[model samples]
Every structure is written in structure tokens, then in C-alpha cells.
Target chain A: MQLLIGTQAVELDKEGFLKQLTDWNEEVAIKIAQQEHIQLTAAHWEIIELLRKFYQLYELSPSMRALVKHTEQTLGAEKGRSVYLLQLFPPSPAKLACKIAGLPKPLNCI
Target chain B: MTTNNKSITCKKLLFISRHAPYGTSLAKEALDAILAASAYDQNLSLLFMDDGVFQLLSAQDPSDLEQKNFAAMLPVLALYEIENIYVHFESLQARQITINELILDGVQVIDSKTICSLLTQQDQLLSF
Candidate 1:
């Protein structure tokens, strides 16, 4: 059983994924501000929020490779800098950022 | 020594980073947060593990790399009473750094166990 919001159907999960949303949001935001010298602008927030949504929907943070392709297509050209995202977050954005975001340090961060 | 109330009012920010100062913006950013919190009278501490220990390695030659001279900032931390600087023992051993090779005064060198203990004492922790 799942709930519906707008055109989308949100799944009701037996898994613990729902418990992690708030923590994941705050951690990644704070980390970006502290680690990358990024002030967490509205633009930056979009990526993490999208990542979290995708995580909740799919149960995993996307790979940088996956995220870049997704960001390029969805966010338009100004936001598709895989290199910039990597430079800003380092290694993998989904792994590190998502971990700080509190969704369980995406297995790849280590 | 002037930090926003955010630092002192909060329990602690256990900052962990693995990059050398000036290697990337991380060191400088960490310094800015520390100074901001210090201004607020926040008590802060740091541990340099892995590449981060390189930031404390004495006699930095920033001119050789054409980067800003940031080794100069390590000493001023004490002026702010931010005395809890620790460099991991294995990190130093792996890099062949002696206790004397680091530039900061009164810096502690501890094993992994001690570092783990310190983390447990902190109210909050962060990594970069």
C-alpha cells in the first residue's frame, strides 16, 4: 500500500528508509556549507533535494555517473558540471553528500 | 577569540578533514568556521588524519607550490584557546613525521584509540 501525491504514487515501505529523510537533509546541507565553502544556495539545494527524493523513491543514492547524466538532462546545461560537483563535493556527491544527508553513508563513500 | 554565539552555545564541532591546508579550499574553510565559532566563544577541537596531517607538517614551503602561506595560521589557534589539535599516530608514522616536525605548539599526538575516545566525548562531529 502506498500514498498518492499529485500524479505520483508514493510507496508505503516496510523498510526503514522513511525514518532517514530529515537527517539526510540537514547533514548534507551543513556539510556543503562547512566543507566546500558553499553557502547552500537555492541552486545547490535542488541537487540534494532531488537526490533525496530519488533515494526515497528508489532506495539508493545515484552514482556520480548517474547523477551527472540526470542533472544534465533535468537541470539544463548551467548545472551539469560533473567536474564542478565533484570538486565541490569530492569523490562521489551521492555517497559523501548523501551520507552527510544522513541516508546511511552511501556504501561507496568509504 | 571573537566567535559567534553559535560556537560556544553549541556543544562542540568535531571537525575532521583529510586534505592539506591550501591543497583545496577545505583547510581555509575549516579555519573560517573555527574563527567564526571562536568569535562566538565556541570551544572547538580538530584531528588531522590521513592527508590532513600534512597540513601540520612543519616548515611548509608554500612558495614552492605558489599557494598562499597558510602554515602561519596554525600557531594563532592557541591565541583563540583552540588547543585541542591532534595528529594521528599512524598518520605520522606512515609519513615519517616526528612529534617535533609539526609547527603547532602543544599539539598532541595520539593513537587511534585516543582519537576514537575524543570523538565519543564530542556532542557533534563532522568530516570533510
Candidate 2:
């Protein structure tokens, strides 16, 4: 799959995960979120920033469980709960969040 | 192993770590898979035996080796609800290390007998 980010075609995997990490930017994130039918909010951006930080620090994308833990650590417990995250990013929060953050899909996502 | 039993749904998934941490990326890769499995809310257990015991040792500084301290992520396992971490007691004794020397707490020490029993309960096992 491909996303047209300002006239530039950005490649994506078949599952809609980012094809290249460096190709991610705020604009790309917005596009990806849009494709997922999610409107970017401060709350959503909060998770996205946290995911990006995790990738930078560990050089690896966090798994769903790690994402929740990171959320609880950085944000609060209320936002860290899986139910709350599911409300924000329906379906899979970690996968959608990483795609928007320009990181690879969590290997255990399947 | 032949499948004499009928088809069953996957529930318990075990991750076995036997490699020395930091010398290779195997440890970290294994962790990524474990974390991913945990996210799916699967029944996840981790067994650290053999050189894998070295991964739990404290005071690991990989700066000289230009490697990230991947072991630092061990403490975060609890966040993923992976509280069933098991280490081979004999493996630790063989390495001349004790449980008190480990970086984190709550890791269970089990013998090979228990390892065999745990294997029987798992629907899948991933080893590194």
C-alpha cells in the first residue's frame, strides 16, 4: 500500500505498516491516522510521542504490553489501560501507533 | 513429536533463552517476540537457562563494547504482565551466581524437572 503525502507517494507494507522508518513525519502520521479513520488529538499524539521515544531509546518498537507499560509510566494509569487505548486507536493500538510513529510493525503483532 | 492429541487452541506460549546477552542480538530479538506475545494477551512464560542467566546479572555496562544495555529492559517485563520468568537454578550455580546477584526480583528458580513439566503445558515454545 502507498500513502500520498503532499504529492509524494510513501510506501507501506501490505498490512499498512510503514515501509521505511525514516519516511515518517508528522504529516505522514496524520495521513496514516486519517486512513485509519482516526482524528489526531492531543491524546493520540501523546501515545505517538511515547512510542517514538521508546524506539529511540531501545532501538526497537515496543510490543503492545510494553506500550501499555510505557503509557502507565509516562502518562497515567487511566490512559494506560488497554480499554482506554482501544478507545483512542481502535483495533490495535500498538500497531497503529507505530505505523504513525514511523516505526516497524511489532514482530509479535500477528 | 507426533500429534496423537486432537487439535487444540494455543494458550500458553513459552520463550526459552539460552544465549549470552550482549555478545549477540539474539537476547534482544527474543525479548521483542516475548513482548509482542504479551501484548496479544497470550499466556506467556520465559525461561532463562544456561548462558541466559548472565542476562539477569546486575551491573552490566556495555559502553565499552558499544552495545546498548539491553538487559535494562528486563525490569519492564512486569509491565507486560510477564511475571512468570523462570531461571534454571543449576544454571545459576554453575555460573557461580546467586539469585541475590540478579538485577531484578520475582524471578522463579526452577529445576530441569519443572522445566519438563512446564514444556508439557505449553502449546508453543520459542528458543533463542
Q: Name the top TM-score candidate.
A: 2
**Per-residue lDDT value at B125 in model 2:** 91
Q: Which DockQ values do the candidates obtain, in the order shown?
A: 0.01, 0.38
lDDT of 1 by residue, B94-120 (tens): 989887888877888889999889998
Q: How many backbone clashes does candidate 1 have?
A: 9
Name the regions of candidate 1 deviating beyond 4 angstroms: A1-110, B1-10
Candidate 1 per-residue lDDT, tens place, A1-110, comes to 33333454433224223233543335435543454455565656677776666555434445455566557766776776777677656666656555444454443223
TM-score of chain B of 2: 0.89
**Candidate 2, pairs of clashing residues:** none
TM-score of model number 2: 0.72
Worst 10 residues of 2 chain A by lDDT: A56-65
Q: Number of clashes in every candidate structure?
A: 9, 0
Fnat values, candidates in order: 0.00, 0.44
Instruction: State each candidate's chain A TM-score.
Output: 0.58, 0.93
Docking class of 2: acceptable
- Clash-forming residue pairs, model 1: A24-A101, A24-A102, B2-B39, B3-B38, B3-B39, B3-B40, B4-B40, B7-B42, B8-B42
